[model samples]
Target: MAIDILSHRDPKVATDILKIQQESYAVEAELINFSDIPPFRDSVQSIVENDETFIGYMIEEKIVGVLAYKEEQEEIDIYRMMVDPAYFRRGIGESLLKHLFATMPNKPVVVQTGKGNEPAVNLYLKYGFEPVDEVEVEPDVWIVMMKKAQ
Candidate 1:
């Protein structure tokens, strides 16, 4: 697998990331019983305009995973970290996270995932992230915010 920074100006890359995001986040939506997830509502234009840096994972020249984030002076907030559902359990998500940690060592990183998404929660925990808060975005739908200090 090849990992590289994705350019917002590249429509094809953005489109591919959108597709993967939809597929991956759909699983989370189902797990959490929430249909109003942001990824499902995102458009290519919004993704480009979000000003987040995207890192894409490719296999055989096709993008299968993506990690996007916004960097601040004191911390980095992970906007999205997803792997194609078809490629789950293959370590794509882990690789993307490891890459992020390696590139931004010792900086605080934060991420949010559906509260009921055990797989995601476990993955974050595996990487030493601690749950800091829970946010209710809709009725009975909660988001778990986790933080990892390097």
Candidate 2:
């Protein structure tokens, strides 16, 4: 298993990232009972044009997980955390989060996930992220925003 930076400019890389993203977000959509999560609408072209930095977790050269984030002067905003369902329960997401914390230390970290997604919320809470807000995005759907202080 290896984790490395992924260039969105590479078509093949962008395609792989998009595939993992769709598959992963599909699970989140089901958990939240909402299918309109923004990542589902992404294409390879859109991923290639995105401004976030992507890091991929690989096994034998195949990307099995991806984490995308943007670093700013005050904080690091985590945009996406995806692990292929076929590769779930293997610590891929935790590994990617650890990599981010290691590489971008001393910055507040922020992320949002489905309010009903227990696994994701637990993971963030386990790592010291506290729930800061909960926004209802749809009639019955909500998103929870979490933050970890610097």
Mind giving the per-residue lDDT tens digits that candidate 1 earns over 63-144? Answer: 9989999889899999999999999999998999999998974789999999999999999999999999999999999999
- lDDT (CA) per prediction: 0.90, 0.94
What C-alpha lDDT, on a 0 to 100 scale, does residue 26 get in candidate 2? 94
Off by over 4 Å in 2: none
Model 2 per-residue lDDT tens digits across residues 1-150? 999999888999999999999999999999999999999989999999999999999999999999999998889999999999999988998999999999986999999999988889999998899999999999989999999997
Clashing pairs in 1: none
Question: For each candidate, what TM-score against the reference?
Answer: 0.96, 0.98
Residue 109 lDDT in candidate 1 = 96
Error of 1 at 145 (Å): 0.7
